[model samples]
Target: MSISNGIGNLQGLSNPVTPASATVQTGKEEQIKSSVSLAPGAVKTTPVTDQTVISSTSELLTRALSGSDVRLDKIQPLQAAIAAGTYQVSSSDLADKLITSLLK
Candidate 1:
């Protein structure tokens, strides 16, 4: 077969077929309507209020801290020593505390 004849047959096959138009009847459609209404006393709503209560332990802790003395001069020296890696803990004391806690 000739190449031109084969290409022409392919071009004719590639042409799209036209689809038929759909027919619709009008002026006979039905419509639906809906609504909702509540009676005067149907839903009763009360005013909402928020309250907060502090526990006795929390109140005591707040009062204790407020009246306590914080020795910053002593604390600053210890903090500096710890930051400089010069603060040392006794191994005997640490082991004793660890064993005590473990036993408890």
Candidate 2:
């Protein structure tokens, strides 16, 4: 199965290819919106109701990460250790992990 971003391009769909900006020939009120199927039983047909777009990548990431919580309880101890010059780094372990990740 193929996946599409579905925001605009519809080159290979079984459904009629309609660009998001396609104007309705008969009506001024409705514009033809495209439906993209990422996989079989993946994309469900929802009513063409509203069109909302994220302004930018940063804005999209900000909105996506907005409601997430930071674990200050864990971070505070790490910060304290670093500040007091007690934080230890295992060079061999770090090298091993870095090599393993590169292999993957």
Candidate 3:
């Protein structure tokens, strides 16, 4: 056995009421003007200047990242050791560094 629910009858699913278009009418012509006037003493004008001060730490970092202080010779071996799973960390050294950073 089979049943037909008339799912193809889209006319029954549509809205029966239609919306009417709205019309707006306006009668008057007016001119709008905006103006601002400041008294002589009301406004204070000072020379605008901008200044930037780099911290010593940031300057050091920038210098380091400029590739001048990078020791690729030392880093390449460390990277290779790490990739080979043979890199080792000294417990005392690691603890000392952790404490130093925490203190900072």
Point to the candidate with the largest TM-score. 3
Query: What is candidate 2's lDDT per residue for 1-104, written digit by digit as tens?
Result: 97777766655655654555563455533433333424534665768898887679979888889966888899999999999999998999999999999999
Model 3 residue 29 CA deviation in Å: 46
What's model 1's lDDT at 86? 100
Predicted candidate 3 versus true structure: per-residue lDDT over 1-104, tens digit per residue: 97879865656633332222222224322111112223334564668999998899998888778866667999999999999999999999999999999999
State the number of backbone clashes in model 2.
0
Task: Please report how far candidate 3 places residue 70 from its true position, in Å.
Answer: 1.4
Identify the runs in model 2 with alpha carbons over 4 angstroms from their true place: 1-65
What is the clash count of model 3?
0
What are the clashing pairs of model 3?
none
Find the 10 residues in a row with the least total lDDT in model 3.
28-37
TM-score of each prediction: 0.33, 0.34, 0.35
CA lDDT, every prediction? 0.64, 0.71, 0.64
Whole-model alpha-carbon lDDT for candidate 2: 0.71
Name the better of 1 and 2 by lDDT.
Answer: 2
